[model samples]
Target: MTGAALAVALGSTGLVAVGTPAAYAVTPSDEVAKLPIASFGAMVVDDAHERVYVTDGRRSSGESAVLVYNFQGQRVGSLPTDQPVSGMALSADGATLHVSQSHRMLTFDTATQTRSGASFVPYDVTCGRDVAVAGGKTWFTETPYNDPYCDRPDNIASLYGVSGTSHVNTGWQSQGRLKLAAGPGAPDRLVVGQAAAGADANPFLTTYDASGETLVRGPQRRFADAEGKGALDLKDIAQSADGKRIAVADGAYGTRLLDASDLSDAAAAYQPLPDGAKSTAVAFSGDGTYVARGAAASGSTPDLLIQPADPANGTTPLEFAFEGELDGLRVAPRGLGWSKDGTRLFAVTSNGNGGLWLHVIKPPAAQHDSRFTGALGTTPAKPVVGEPLGIRGRLELDGPAPAEPVKVTAVRKDADGTQEVAAAKVAADGTFTVLDVPDRLGEATYTLRFLGDVTHRPAEDVTVTVDVAKAPTAVELTAPAEATRTGGVEITGKLTGQGRALPSGIGLKVTRTDRFGTTGELTSASVAADGAFRVRDLPSKRGKTVYEVSYAGDALHSGSSARATVKITG
Candidate 1:
């Protein structure tokens, strides 16, 4: 009877309905720092120097500086850049941080936070630049125009490469701006995604082999279903430490996990964010232990989450719900960064004012394990179609008690295909019940899962199959032995049904067969609340006649029949 979680069902409508369990920290926020300006472009964490750098993309911030902080969020120092800074990246060796400015790519030493050198980009930067380091060089996106022409296909948004004090134009062109991503071991892996500012309806996302002399295009993709429902709204793209998987932060869709080889949807996807929360940024930690998802949202809904990188693992993420002015509202785009060891995470948040805050968090390194005990059982021994059914089971956790109760998610697969059940709450006693109504007769299977939390590891799935039977319904009849031809004969019957009440005012199908072996249709008898019905028929020929009553089954009931015979006198 004791449980800590709330019960909320995913309505039969298939809309997502997440229960708001109390939020508990996997680990408390280590530090919070106020940024020099609210304007943010991106963040990069330097594990080698034990520092983190954040860029201020405000072109009018006067003298913009790359704000620097220690791993603990203590303000270490700032490297003053002549112009506003935007996208940033660190070298494979982690010795230098590459930052993009209006017309130049600047380099700074992570060890001393000092500006080292700069290379001029070929074009006049207007839409700003996105920078990344791969194949032992720096790559960036360039847009030549300064006004509303940024989205023009003629504007010729291009990619440029920088190495050894030389700026080499890659000659790759697109209608709009491009976003770039490359990590420590992914030198050969360079990703460019389109952001057309509304011009390009179907923007392309392509990967390149930065390892070779000429950039070789790898897997390329542009998404739009047959009905054109899912379109890519690219915000950020991150590669796993091993460079096998790519996670795209899609505003139109939730976080998309894609295989880096072909850019296809991964086998399993992370559970959706609470409704109304759009993906703003996504990144994998350097060690590949966790993946962080940032979103812009309100209230108790999460604005940031850190979970396992393997979607198939289904671990509940360590959640962060950013509320009012005390700590910014939501995570800014490209606001997430992690230390190489996956021990420290940096999140940038905006307060809607001209203010920004940096948060430092440490996630649990190891998870407490969990398992579901006891065989699954239903309240009623046998279930009938169209009736509420409850499948009960118990979940046990190995570690200390959870900060809040956990929940178990389930899916029901029947003749109608698969449907998600409303999540069930795990009681303090580890007991929870999966509730659903079987819509079809035959066998249905329910699969229950526990995507573990910061406190626990994911449990193996348990399945239970159920047999559903049609509801029973019958027709009862009462008749007179004989009747005169002058008075029409009246036949009476009652209809009874089981499982949810049969609808009122139902008509039973009736037919009459004469002694001559000719059959004819008769007016149907309407059944009342009391299940009583009567119908009259006059025999054209004086002979024996048979009246047959039948009730065809509905969605949940089986059909039944009744018959009566009468002899007529002339």
Candidate 2:
């Protein structure tokens, strides 16, 4: 196929359908700058000033440099370095750019593109491949490139942190070293894909905090390997906008998802692509709902896959392939000064003669535009029998409020079955409240749903658990040795469980069965604050007597000890 056809097939737009397929601009609005480097390890863009910063490492002479370029593709400034550069990072504010070169960490001012600081903190491993700047600290990974087959050293991988104020040339002590899976978190935490020393030897995920302290670790989970051959290699990691979810690039195995809150296990909800693609780069959109992955194979152009951040319904990713040669691939988003309004993307290409090529990517139009916000609240649970209970919540939204009318519905289900209870519309501030749950109608679980005029986006339903309260659990009935018309019985017990105190009221009913087989209903009393119940006014009948306590609608019978022979007193 002609180059233009190939470019179109590879998801590029810059093309002319002529005899030889001429190359034009794809997203002319989105541009890229070239650098003087044979091969690139890592690169970052400064979208605020329309400039790009790249690490230029000359393999033969072992010389390294940091080169800067404008969005219009002009060489602006270059900084010479003694050691080769490996990874790069930009501060949250985009004021500083941190570069991880051979055995040292260097910083440059974003405004001037000059060396601001330097440090010689020899990383645990040689190749300081990935770098991230966040929370006032710089983080990078040291992975050995020498022996890819050898059993990775227990200490072969580590994440180093340096304060922004620390000079780049100072020989600083490593904040801490940790065994991670593959890609660590850039600015703050390091998300590793390997196992620490333990019985759970499977390849898992963990995050090391900014202080180089291990914050959270994921349960043992397996990933695909390099060739899509064995299990996956957790090679690259990226976080969603809200930082609640993490996307792990498993070479050949595809990408995996983990909960950012605890870094515990793969989210129960996730979507994996078809196996066989070698995923190299992973990135997330600002809202944390979309994720993009870059894939390529030997002797082929690279492809891009876009999927939902946390996909539950098995959906496929939107795939786009690269048109020309794939070189230094990095994600430059907009909104953050380093990215163009956080929408455009740039891909660096390399020709045989050591020149740089650039490819610009424009995001597809947005699929949905509505937004949702709300505060969820639950009732004072664990109420005793016959107690009233419920849950309350509120919702908020932006833009002209929906006026066509909205409804809030509550659906409850239990060991018995499911039932719908309440429905209401959103108030002016886009607020809605629900109250007064029914009595324990043998139900254990309840869900709340909000239906609006527009079905494009429905408020997610919330779940509330309804369980039997244990307060006033057990009741004891004691009869006097001699039957007496004035003497009664005392019932005392503690209520305990996840939910015990029902707000409305706590009532109990007592019943007695005589030896004559006749059953008599006794006095009913409200349970005390301590879940204690006492009833008086009993019959002086002899033979044997049985006592039972009923709370709400469920009944409990006391042990046979509550039954005993009675004699009339003098």
Candidate 3:
């Protein structure tokens, strides 16, 4: 049918017509920063200086300097070191940055960005070291050579007292490489855990009393099922501000929240991660209000999640996925760090190419609720199968005006099953229309949703039911089975339509063709209130005569035709 004819045919049917984009849409995540780093080693956020320090560990790179970036992600300066840097730690007052080199420990003044002091006389340090400040003193770790054993019982990894002489051990020793974390403002509380190594079957984690000069080990842990199924594959650990809770990034599990006092499971835990993403890092904001969890995932999978620290809040975490060229594929191990105010999070991402990128992301931490207002409305009041449909409703957001137009997604459920409808952008006045072309012919239920952005909470779902129907028009004919060649011969028929009643007294053009070599156009029949019509004709001759009747379709009803055969006996 021509476009003009199809438009006229559907004019009275009251089906909605619309124009929309054909591409599918995803949640928008702005690219805030893309630092070109040759390699990724460590990332630490300095709240006091409003700067972030990153380094290229002893990998394939030969440059021996710590790259510094302000909270906004601009390259500020570099802290040149004697050797490649490993673990980085900040003092309790945030004045000094303690960096661990191969065989020595160095401290940098945050105010001057210059080296303050250094220490040596350490055992030949081949394996990189991890450093931290605890118990009002600085401490460092030492693992012999570059080999981390999994089965050895020897005291290969030892803890040292760095406050005065880091060259000597504080008398705490373990079998594998150890990682450290301290509660901000709670130097007395220290957390140490074993990095999963080649030999240790059950890695250990314990808290320590750092208020004293001596190391006092506290509640210890090594998670394993009865059959030793779920052993701890520790990547990173973080201490809460209140010194009451701890969060661990476990490769086996996602994020595990533990009680600070006993190192047991906390009353609540973090939500499960999106599929195919494993826990690579975890950190609690300095204020203890939010937590950032990092995962090594690709494509549209979430690589970072920032959500409420308290699992009880149950707020959906803001998600970030890095894809496309110039974008990293996944989050590196222990790659997420947060600023003091939770305003910014610094992440290190590495792509398939040997390059790495430093990303400064500001996740949505504040949210306002949203709801639909008034009654739901739609275009073309009654819906029809294979026709465009428009469901319109107004959304009232509790937050300030958004930076960009808000989008509303819709899903339809019917006999064939559920399908996702193309998302519609809301207008500045908060009115939005969801358009769809329903493929099925049964009851179609539309469920509209607002996934909410960085500043808004998801709106409550709105549902509307639509009755879809098929287009109308049918024909039936009646004639004597055997008609004589007389003037009494008459053919009658009835026309019917579905959706709306046909226009009364509408004219239906008719045609008649005899089985013989004779054919002629019959007079147009006027339809009656009962939708019945008739045609009368006289047979010129006789053998068999065929009478065919047809009605041209209209705006609301399709065209139909019927034929009757009579044995015209002479």
224-280 per-residue lDDT for model 2 (tens digits)? 345433453554667766566776766646666677766545645343432344666
Please give the distance, in angstroms, between residue 109's alpha carbon in candidate 1 and its true position after superposition: 1.6
Q: How far is 351's C-alpha from truth in model 2 (Å)?
A: 7.7
lDDT of candidate 3? 0.73
How well does model 1 score by local distance difference test? Answer: 0.79
What C-alpha lDDT values do all the predictions have? Answer: 0.79, 0.50, 0.73
The positional error of residue 256 in candidate 1, measured at the CA in angstroms, is 2.7
Clashing pairs in 1: 2-428, 3-427, 3-428, 10-422
TM-score (C-alpha, index-matched) for candidate 1: 0.70
Give a tens-digit lDDT track for model 3, residues 1-570: 000000000010111212121222232333334555565657788898898998775532244888888887789889998677777888888899988787778889999999998877365344566777887787778776544442244546878867443466777877767888886746787788887644546788898888875878888998877787778888888887677888899988889999888989998777667678889888888877788888887666667777778876534456666664555777777788888887777878767566677777676557888888878887788776566789999999886877667777788989988787888888999999999977666688998877666567667778998887655577788888777777546878898876556778777766655676587777777778998888777776776677777767666456777878777776
| Model 3 weakest 10-residue run by lDDT | 1-10
* Worst ten in a row by lDDT for model 2: 1-10
> How high is the lDDT of residue 372 in model 1?
94
Give me the candidate number with maximum lDDT: 1
Q: Cα lDDT of model 2 overall? A: 0.50
Ranking by lDDT: 1, 3, 2
Which run of 10 residues does model 1 get worst, by summed lDDT?
1-10
Q: Provide TM-scores for the models.
A: 0.70, 0.48, 0.70
